[model samples]
Target: MAYVFLAVAIVSEVLATVSLKLSEGFSRLGPSVLVCVGYAVAFVMLSQALVRGLGVSLAYGTWSAAGVALVALIGAGFLGERLSGIQIGGIVLVIGGVLALELGAEHGP
Candidate 1:
């Protein structure tokens, strides 16, 4: 499953992004290392998903949108970041767009 790999890629990417914030401009050793390693895993898994026949448009759209939403949520929940109502709406739009992409892909030629 390419979907499985995609999920891994999404999770790894989210983790890497969160770790980047924790890394404090790469001044912190542990989270900095995690940021580097997590991104590596994310890219490798994403490449595997692409190689396994996932369309580039669909895969990248879904991956990037989902990562953005997840990172925003994590930041708000754990990092005391404030999300305005407009930002929340934007996240909803991103998710809706990803779902539309998936649905369209299923009906695509």
Candidate 2:
């Protein structure tokens, strides 16, 4: 399904971004390779989703919002990153906005 491809795209993008952080400015070989491969796979999957009839606006908005939220959680939980209350609120807003976008798309012509 298109949604499945979208999910893969989102998760791949998130992993790519996290791997980029772990890549140490590209000095690390393993994570650097992962970053490159992950992003490539993500874009391909995203393209597949688009080709499968997911609206561009809805798909991109949801993908990016979910990626941001998931990356923030991973950063805070495993990467020793600090998240302020404002950042947390922003994440919640991003999620709410994505939900609103999905709901609107569902009800729209």
Candidate 3:
């Protein structure tokens, strides 16, 4: 379904972004390939989700916010990037807001 594609888009994008770090500024081969393929897959799936039935605001907002949080986590936990307490709180708020929107989403149009 559209939601399935949306989920795929999010996961692929997160993987691609994380691989970006491992790509070493695109100097490496394996991670570089992953970055390219993952981004391609992500956009493709996002388009498919739109065509299928998802709302534009719902899908786009969730995708953008989730991608940011996932990327931050990957950098902080895996890449040793520092995450301040305030930033962590903001991330949690973003996630909660997204979930609330999804759960209480309006359907008309």
Candidate 4:
């Protein structure tokens, strides 16, 4: 389903972004390779979802919002990064905005 592909796209993009930090300015081989491969797979899955009738804005917005949330959680839990209430609220707003965009978009152009 397109939803599955979209989910994969989101998760891969998030993983790719996090791995980017671990890539150490492109000096690290393993994480750099992971960054490249994960992004490539993400884009491919996104393209598949687009072909399956999801709007690009909707798909990308949701993907980006969810990616931020997941990355934040991963950072806090695994990397010992800290998050303030404001940051959490902002992330929540991003998610709500994505949902609004999807629900409000015109079905036909």
Q: Model 4: runs farther than 4 Å from truth?
A: 106-109
Question: Which candidate, 1 or 3, has the higher TM-score?
Answer: 1
Please provide, for model 4 over 1-109, each residue's C-alpha lDDT reduced to its tens digit, 9 standing for 90 to 100.
9989999999899889889989999899999998999999999999999999888998889788989999999988887899999999999999999988877785543
Clashing pairs in 2: none
Write one digit per residue (lDDT tens) for candidate 1, span 36-106. Answer: 99999999999999999998888898899999999999999999999999999999999899889889878
Error of 2 at 81 (Å): 0.2
lDDT of 4: 0.91
Candidates by TM-score, descending order: 1, 2, 4, 3
Preferred candidate (TM-score higher): 3 or 4 = 4
Q: lDDT for every model?
A: 0.95, 0.95, 0.90, 0.91
What's each prediction's TM-score? 0.94, 0.93, 0.85, 0.91
Local accuracy of candidate 2 as per-residue lDDT tens digits, 4-107: 99999999999999999999999999999999999999999999999999989888998999999999999999999999999999999988998888898789
Off by over 4 Å in 2: none
Backbone clashes in model 1, listed as residue pairs: none
- Cα distance off (Å), candidate 4, residue 77: 1.0
Clash count list over all predictions: 0, 0, 0, 0
